[model samples]
Target chain A: MTPQLEIVIIAVIVSAACSVLGVFLILRKMAMMTDAISHTILLGIVVAFFITESLTSPLLIIGAALVGLLTVYLTEALRRTRLMAEDSSIGIVFPFLFSIAIILITKYAGNIHLDVDSVLLGELVFVPFDRLIVLGRDIGAKSLYVMGTILFIDLLYVILFYKELKLVTFDAALAAVLGFSPIAIHYSLMGLVSITAVGAFEAVGSILVIAFMIGPPVSAYMITDKLRNMLILSTLIGIINSIIGYRLSVIFDVAIAGSIATVIGITFLIVFITAPKRGMLTIINSRRRRKIEYAMASLLLHLCNHENTDREEIESNRHSIYQHLNWSKKFLEKILYKALNLNYITLNNEYLKLTPKGREYAIRCYDDIGYSI
Target chain B: MQKHVIEVEDMTVAYEEKPVLWDIDINIPKGVLMAIVGPNGAGKSTLIKAMLNLVKPISGKVLFNGLSYECQRRYIGYVPQRGSVDWDFPTSVLDVVLMGTYGKIGWIKRPGKKEKEKSLDAIKKVGMEEFVDRQISQLSGGQQQRVFLARALVQDADIYFMDEPFQGVDAKTERAIINILKELRLRGKTVIVVHHDLQTVKEYFDWVALLNTKLIQYGKVDEVFTDENLRITYGSTDRVLKGEV
Candidate 1:
C-alpha cells in the first residue's frame, strides 16, 4: 500500500497502454504525428489551465485531446491543399502552438503554482501521491484512473474499427469505395492518439513517451510479421522495458523515465541484431552459411564425378576441375580432406569411393539446397 | 427496354476552376459490362469519380437506379485505381472484403457472422478463397486487384463502378477478373469497368463507352464499335475517319 509501488504500477500500465496504440501508429508511419501531438498538447493544457484556473482539472485532459484532434484535422487539411508537405505542415503547426503556450506560461502563469518542467519531463515519483478517493475510500492514484480510461478508449476504438482502420491505413481509396470512410477512421485514430498523449503526458514526459509509443512497437515489428502478434509483442516489450528500467534506475540512482527509455532503446537494439529470419545478424550468417554449403555441395559433386579416376589422373585434372568449380585449391583440399575423414569418400591409391553416409548426405544436401532456392 | 442503371446528364467536373471532364452525357442499361476508355488525360478516371459522387462535377446530375447517390448509396459499389492505396497496410484479404458490408451494417455496429459469411462468399467468387487470410501486402499485383473486386462483390450491389481494375494485373488474373465480371452480368448485376486494352475491348466488354474529354460513343459492342467511331474516339483527330476497304 506504499506510494512507490503504486507509482511503478501506474507507470507500467500507462507505458503499456501507449505502446498498444503506438504499434498501429508506427505501422501506419504516423510516429512523428505522435511527437507533434505531444508538443502541441502544451497549448491545450495552457488554454485549459487559463479557463479552469486549476492544474488538476479534468478540463486540461479534455482540452488537450480536442487540440490533438484539431492538430490532425489541420495537418490533413494542409496536406490536401498542396501548400506544404506533411513533415513541414507538422513542423509549422506544433512549434507555433507550443511557442504560444510557452509565452503564455512565462507572461501570466509564471507567478502561479504551475510547473511546465514537470509537464515536459513527467514526475513519476509524485504520481502516486495524487490519490483518487471514491466515497471517502482511497481507490488508487488519480493518474491511474485517467490513464486507465484512456487505455479503455484506445482498446475500444481499436477493437471496434480494427478492420476499417487496417483497410484505410493500407488502402484509403479502397476503403472509401467499400463504404468505409478513411477520413472518419483517420480522425478517430488520431483522436485516440491525442487522448493517450494528453492522458499520459503528465505521468511520462513527452520525450520518454515517444520511447514507449514507438520503441516497443518497432522492436516487435522487427521480430514479427503479423499485426495481431505485433500488438501482443509490443505490450510485452513495453512492460519489460518499464520494469527493467525502473529497477535499473533504483539500482543506479538515475532518472526513472530516462532509464526506461534507455531500456527500450537497448531492447530494440537486441531485437534488431538477433530477431529470427529477418535480423541483421541472422541474414548475414545465413548468407555465409549458404556460401559454405554451396562450395561443399559442388566439391562433393566434383569428387563423385571423378571417383573412377586414378590419383595421378585426379591430381593432373585438379586445375580444370577447380576452374569448373570456381573454388580455390586450398578450400577444395580442406573440404576434400574433411569428406575423407568423415568416410563420405575414400582416397585409395588416387581413386575416390563414395561411402553410404557420404552418398546419403550429398542427396539430402541437394534436396535442401534445391528446395531453398 | 430495360431501365438505365446509370444516367449522367451534361456532367462537367473540374478542380480549382479548371475543367477535367467536360459535358459528359451517358446512359447505361442494366446487366451490361461497360468499359470507359480514353487517353491518359482524357478524364476517364474523373468521369467515374463524378458518377460515384467522389469528385464533385462542376455542373450536372448523376442518377443510379433512378435515384440520387444519397438515396441509393448502398445499391452502388466502387473500386478505385490500384495505385490509390498503400499496399503495405495491415489487413488480410478477408478483412478488406468484410468492409463491403459496412454500408449495410451502418456505423458503430461491428460486422457480424452474416457479414463474414458474405465476405467469404465474395472471396470465393474471385477465386481468392485460399488467400483469404493472407495480408494484402503479401499478395501479388493480380491477387491485390482480385481482393478489391471481392470487396466490391461483398457489397452485393446492383451496379458496380471499377476504375482500372486490371492496370497492373497479369493476363491470367485479368482473365479471372473478367470471368467474375461475366458471372456478375449473368446474375443480372450491371458492372462498369474503366479499361485500357483496346485490343481485348471487344472480348471483355459487352457494352462500351468511348470517351475523349467528352462522350463520343455509348452503346453495345456491335452497335457503336465502328471504324469511324474508333477513329473519332482514339485517332489523332476527331474529324479523321479511317476508311474500311
Candidate 2:
C-alpha cells in the first residue's frame, strides 16, 4: 500500500476504536474519564520503561493499559468516599498521576526517544516512517496492526455484551437487581477504553485520542434517537472525519493530529447546529414557533373574554389592545396580523371581534392555562 | 395461613453513618397487592432497594421465596421512580420494555423474537402500544410512568416492586395503573408499591405497611390502615390524616 494510503488507514482505524467506546462513555457520563486515562497512562509507559530498560518493549502497552485501569479504579474509589463529587475526584486523581508521569520522564529518561511532546501532541505525519517488519520483511505501519487489533477487540466486546452494556449504562440499579454485576461490566468497559487510548496515543497523541473518542459519539447522539443507530453512525462519522482531516493536513502542511482534532470540532459544531430534530437551530425554531402560537392564543382569548362584555369596545380596540396586554405596539401588531391571517379574528371598525373558530381556540387555550392547574 | 413470598428480617440500612431503615422486619404474603406508605424521607424507597440488594444493608437479610436474592432474581421485577432514568437516552419505548427480559436472557444473549412479542404485549397492556416506536424523550410524565410499568410487566416475575408509580401521572393513567396492578394480583403475582397518595390506600391496596423509619403496622388494609397508626407513623400530625382518613 502507498504511504499516504497507509497513513489514512491507520488514522481511520484509530478513530474507529476510539469512537466505539466513546458512545458508552458519553452515555455513562464518564467522558472525563477518557481524558484522565489517556494522560495518566503516560505514567505507565514511563514506569514500564524503567523496568524493561527499553522504549520499544511490548510490555509498555500492557503497562500503560494497567495504569489506565488504575486511574479509573482510584477515581471511583475517591468518588465512593462521598466527601467529594465525581468530577472533583477525577480532577484530583488525573493530575496527580499524570504529573508524576511527566516528572519521571523528564528527570529519569530525558535522553531516551520517549519525549513528552510526541506523546502529548502525536505527529500522525511521521506514522508512515514507523514500519512493522515480520521476519526481516517490511509489512506495514505498526499503528495499523495495533489499532486494527484494538478495534476488533472493542467491536467484539460491544457485540458480545451489547445488552449488558446497555442495561448498565441506562439503568445500573436494574442491572444490579438482575444479577448482571454492573461494576463488572463498568470496569470491563473502562479497561477497553484504557487499552484503546494506549494504542492510539502513539499514533494520534493523547489530545487527539480524546477528540476521536468523544466527538463522533456526541455528533451521532444529535442525529439518532436509537442506541444501535448511534453506534453505527458514530463509526461512520469518525471515518469521514479522519479522511477530511488528513486531506486538510496535507493541503496546509499542518500537524495531522491537530488538523484531525480541528476537523472533529468543526464536525460537531455543524452537527450541533444542523441536526434535524435535536439541533440547536431546530430547537430555536420550534421555540420561536411556540412563542408566536402562544401570543396568538393569548390575543384570541383576550378578545373572547371582552366580546359582548361591558369592556368589549375598550379592551378589544386594536389601537389600545397592546397596552392592556402589556406588549409592545409592534409585537401586538405582528400577533394581530398572524391572528387575522389564521382567520381566528377579524377587525370591525378598529375593534377586534372573534370568529367561531377564534372563540373555540380561545376557550381551549384558557382551559390549558387555567383549568389544567 | 398464606405463605410469605418475601421476608425482611431485622434489616437495617444506612448511608455513610446515618441510618435510613432501622432494624425493620416485615413479611409479605403471596399474591397480595400491598402498599408501603410513609411520609417523605421515611426510607420507603430505601427499604425496597435494600430488599432487592441494590443497597447494602448494615445488618439484616431478606429472603425471597425462602431463597436469597441472587437465586430468586429471575422471579422478581422492579420499577424505579419515573424520574430515576434519563428519558432522552436515545432509545424507544419498545427497547426500554425489552430490557425486562435481559435478566432472563442471561449474560451475552440478546433479546429475540419471543422477547419482542412479550414486550409488545406488555406495552399493549399499559395502553401504550401506539407509542411503541416513539422515542422515550417525547413521552409525557404519565406516558413515561406507563412505559416503566410495561417494562416491569415484561419481567413476568412472581413479585413486582414499584416505587411511587402514581407520582406525576394524570388521573386516567393512575386508574390505568391500578387496573394493571389488580390484574397482576388476579394472576397470583405479589405486587408491592411504595405509594404516596393516602386517599387511595384503602380503596386500592388489599394490604398496607405503615412505616416511619421503622415498621409501625402491617396487615390487611382495613385493619392496619387506621387513623391511629397513621398518626403515629406521621408523627402525631393529625394534619397528615385530616383528609386522608
Candidate 3:
C-alpha cells in the first residue's frame, strides 16, 4: 500500500478505538482522567526503556498501562482524601509523572530515537516507514497492525462489558449492591485506556490522542441519545475525521496527526452548533417558543381578570392592556400575533377577547401558577 | 414471633474516625414496609449503605437470611438516591430496567427474552410502560424516580434497600412508588427506605426504625413513631420538625 494510504489507515484505526472508549469516558465524566493518564504514560515508557533497554519490549506496554492505572488510582485516592476536588487531584498526579519523564529524557536519553515533540504531537509521516516483516514475507505498516489490534481489543471489551459499563456508569452504588464491583470495571477500563495510549503514541502523539479520544464521542453524544447509537456515530465521525484530515494534509503539506486532530475539533464544533435536538439553535428556538407561550398565557390571564370589567368599551382594549402590562409594543404584537395564529384570541374592533379555547388555557395557567381561578 | 429477614449486629460506621453511626443492632422482619427516618446528616442513608456493604463499617455484620451479603447478593436489590447518577446518560428506560437482570445472568451473559419480559412487567407496574423506549434524560423527575424503582423491581430480590425514592417525586409518583413498595411487602419481600418526611411515617410504613447516629427506635409504627422519639432522633428541632406544626 502507498505510504499515504497506510498513514490514513493507521489514523482511522486509532481514531475509531479512542472514540468508542471516549463515549464511556464522557458519560462517566472521566474524559480528563484519560488525558492525565495518556500524559503520565510517558513516565512508564521511560522507566520501561531503562529496565528493558529495548524499544519493542512488551514490558513498555505493561509499564505504560500500569502508569495509566496508577494515574487514575492516585487521582481517585486524592479525591477520596476529601482534601482536593477531582480536577485538582488529576492536575497534581499526571504532571508530576510527566515532568519526571521529560526531565529524564532531556537530561539522560539525549541520544535516543524518541523525539519529545513527536511524542506530544505525533508524526504520522513516519508511520508508513515502520514496516512489519513476518515469516520472511512483507506485511503492512506496523502502526496500522498495532492500531488495528487495539481497535479489535477495544471493540471486544466494549461489547463484552456493555451491560456492566452502562450499569456502573449510570449508577455505581446500585451496581455495587448488585454484586458488580464498579471499582473493578473502572480499573480494567483504565488499563485498556493505557494500552490504547501506548499503541497510538508513536503515530498520533499524546496531545492528539486526547483530541481523538474526546472530540468525536462528545460530538456524537450531542447527536444521539442511545448508547449503542452514540458508539456507532462516534466511530463514524472518527473515520470521517481521519479521511478528511488525511486529504487536507496532502493538500497543505502539513503534519498528518495534527490535521486529524484539527479536523476532529472542527467536526465537534459543527455538531455542537447543529445537532438536531441538543444544538445551540434548538435550545434557543425552544426557549423563544416557550417565552411566546408564557407571554400569551399572561396576556390571556390579564383579559380573564378583567372579564367582568366595569368599562365594557375599554376593558379588552390592546392599548390599555399592553400599557397596564408594562409590555413593549413589539412584545405585545409578537405574542398577540402568536395567540391569534393559534385561535386563542380575536380582535373585536380595538378590543382583545379570549376565545373559549383561550379561557380554558388561561384557567390551566392559573393552576400552573398555583392560583385558584 | 416474627421472622427477621435482615439482622444487623453491632453495626457501627465511621467516615475517617468521625463516627457516623454507633453500636446499631437491629432486626428487620420479612414482609414489612420499613422506614429509616432521621433528620439531615443523621445517618439514615448511612445505615442502608452500611447494610448493603457499600460503606465499610468500622465494625459490624449484616446478615440476609442467615447469609453474608456477598453470598446472598442475588436476593438483595438496591435503589440508590436519584441524584447518585447523572440522568443525561444515553440510555432508555428499558435499558435501565434490564440492568436489574444482570445479577441473575452473571458476567458475559446478555439479557434475553425472559429478562426483557421481567423488565417490561416492572415498567408496567410502575405505569411507565409508555416511556419504556424514551431516553432517560428526557424524563421528568418523577418519571426518572419511577424508572429507578422499576429497575430495582426487576431484580425480584427478597429484600430491597431504597434511599430517598420520594426525594423529588410528585405526589402521584410518590403514591405510585408507595403502592409498588406495598405490593412488594405483600408478596413477602422486605422493603427498607431512608425517609426524611415524618408526617407520612405512620400512614405509609408498617415498620419504622428511627436513626440518628444510633438506633433511636425500631418497632411497629405505633410503638416508635412518637413525638418524644422523633424529638430525640432529630435532636430538639423547630416546630415543624418537632411534629407540633
Candidate 4:
C-alpha cells in the first residue's frame, strides 16, 4: 500500500477507536476527563520506558493505561474532598501529573526519540514509515495494526458492556441498586480511554487525540436520540473527518493530525447549526414561533375581555390596540396578521372581535396560568 | 404479626461530618405503602438512599428479607428523584423503561422480545403508551415522572423505594403514580416513598415515618402522623403547620 493510503488508514482507525469510546465519555459528561487522561498518560509512558529501558516495549502501553486510570482516580478523590468542584479538581490533578511527565522527559529522556512537541501534536506523516515485519515479510504500517487492534477491542468492549454502560450513564443510583457496580464499569472505560490515547499518541498526539475522542460523539449527540445510533453515527463521522482531513493535508501540505482535528471541529460546528431537531437553527425557529403564538394568545385574551365590555369600542379598535399592549405598530400588525391567518380574531367595522375559537383558546390559556398559580 | 420486608437497623449517614440521617431504624412490613416525610433537608431522601446503599452509611446496616442489599438486590427496585437524571439523554421512553430489566437480563445480552413486552406493559400502565417511541427530552415534568414510575414498575421486585416521584408532576400524573403504588401494595409488594406533601400523607399512605436527622415516630398513619410528631419533625418552622393543617 502507498504511504499516503497507509497514513489515511491509520488516522481513520485512530479516530474510529476514539469516537466509539467518546460516545460514553460524552454521555457521562466526562469529556474533559479525556483531555486530562490523554495528557497525564505521558507520565506512565516515561516511567515504563525507564523500567524497560526500551521505547518499543509493550509495557509502555500498559503503563500509560494505568496512569490514565490513576488520573481519573486522583481527580475523583480530589472532588470527593468537597473542598473543590469537579472541574477544578481535574484542572489541578491533570496539570500536576502531566507537568511531572514533561519535566522527566526534558530532564532525563532528552536523548530518546520522545519529544514534548511531538507527543502533544503528533506527526501522522511518520506513521507509514513504522513498518511491522514478521520473518522478514512486510506486513503493513505498525500504527495500522496498533490502532486496528485498539478499535477492535473498543468495539468489543462497547458491545459486551453496552447494557451496563447505558444503565450506569443514564442512572448510576439505579445501576447500583441493580448490582451493576458502576465504579467498575467507570474504571474499565477510563482504562480503555487511556489505552486508546497511548495507542493513538504516536500518530495523532495527545492534544489532537482529545479532538478525535470528543468531537464526533458530541456531533452525533446532536443528531441522534438513540445510544446505538449515536455510536454508529460518531464512528461514521470520525471516518469522514479522517478522510477529508487527509485529503486537505495533501492539498495544503499542513499537519495531518492538525488537519483532522480541524475537520472534527468544523463537522461539529456544522452539526450544531444544522442538526434537524436539536440544532441551533431549529431552536431559534421554535423560539420565534412560540413568541408569535404567545402574542396571538394574548391578543385573543385582550379582545375576549373587551368584546362586550363598556370600553369595547375603544379597547378593541385595531388601530389603538398596539398602544394598550405597549408594542410597536409593526409587531402588532404581524401578530394581527398571524391571528387572522389562524382565524383567532375577526375585523368587524375596524374593531377586533374574538371568534368563538379565539374565545375558547383565551379561556384555556387563562386556565393554564390560573391552574398553575 | 406482619412479615417485615425491609429492616433498617441503626443506619446513620453523614456527609463530611454533617449528619444527614442519624441512627435511623425502621422495619417496613410487606403489602404496606409507607411514606417517609420531613421538612426540606430533613433526610427523607437520605433515608431511602441509605437503605438502597446509594449513600454509604457512616455506621449501621439495612437488611432486605433477612439478606444484605447486595445479595437481595434483584428483589429491590429504586426510582430516584425525577430531576436526578439528565432528560436530554439520547434514548426513547421504551429504552429507559427497558433498563429496569437489565438486572434480570444480566451482563451483555440485549433486551429481547420478552423485555420489550414487559416495558410496553409498564408504559401502558403509566398512560404513556403513545410516548413509548418518543425521545425522553420531549417529555414534560409529569410525563418524566410517570416514565420513571414506569421504569420502576418493570423491575417487578418485592420492594420498591422512590425518592420524590411527585416532586413536580401534575395532579393527574400524581394520581396515576399513586394508583400504581397502590396496585403494587395490593400485589403484596412493599412501597416506600420519600414524600414532601404533608396533607396527602394521611390519604395516600398506610404507614408514615416522621424523620428529622433522626426517626421521630413511625407507625400506622392514624397513630404516628400526628400534630405533635409533625411539629417535632419539622421543628419551629411553620412549613409543617401550613402544610399539615
* lDDT of every predicted structure (CA atoms): 0.81, 0.92, 0.89, 0.92
Candidate 1, residues B16-40, lDDT tens digits: the string is: 7678888989988989999987666
Give the alpha carbon lDDT tens digit for every residue of B123-232 in model 2: 99999989999999998899999999999998989999999999989888999999999999999999999999888999999999998888999989988898889889
Poorly placed runs, candidate 4 (over 4 Å): A367-373, B237-239, B242-245
In DockQ, how does model 4 score against the reference complex? 0.71
* CAPRI class of candidate 3: medium
Considering the true interface contacts (CA pairs under 8 Å between chains A and B), give the fraction that model 4 also has: 0.88
Off by over 4 Å in 2: A368-373, B238-245
Q: What is the lDDT of residue B194 in candidate 4?
A: 90
lDDT per residue, candidate 3, B185-230, as tens digits? 9898999999878788888999999888989999999988888988
Q: B1-245, model 4: which lDDT tens digit per residue?
A: 77788899988899988999989888988789999988788798888988888888999999898889889999999999988899999999999999999999888889999999999999999999999999999988999998999899889999999999989888898999999899999998989999988889988999999988999999899999887887788886585556542
lDDT of 3 by residue, A1-373 (tens): 8987888788889989998998989998998998998889988988999999988778988999999998998999999999999999999998898999999889878899776897899888888888888998879898888889889999999999998998889889988988889999999988999999989988889887898889999999999999999999999999999999999999999888878889999999989989999998899999998888788888898888888778645668877777887889989988888889989899998899889999999989988874221
- Pull out the clashing pairs in model 2: none
State which candidate has the highest TM-score. Answer: 4
RMSD of each: 6.1, 1.9, 2.0, 1.6
Cα error, candidate 1, residue A305 (Å) = 20
Quote the positional error of residue A264 for candidate 2 in Å. 0.6
Pull out the clashing pairs in model 4.
A225-B90
User: Which DockQ-derived CAPRI band holds candidate 2?
Assistant: medium
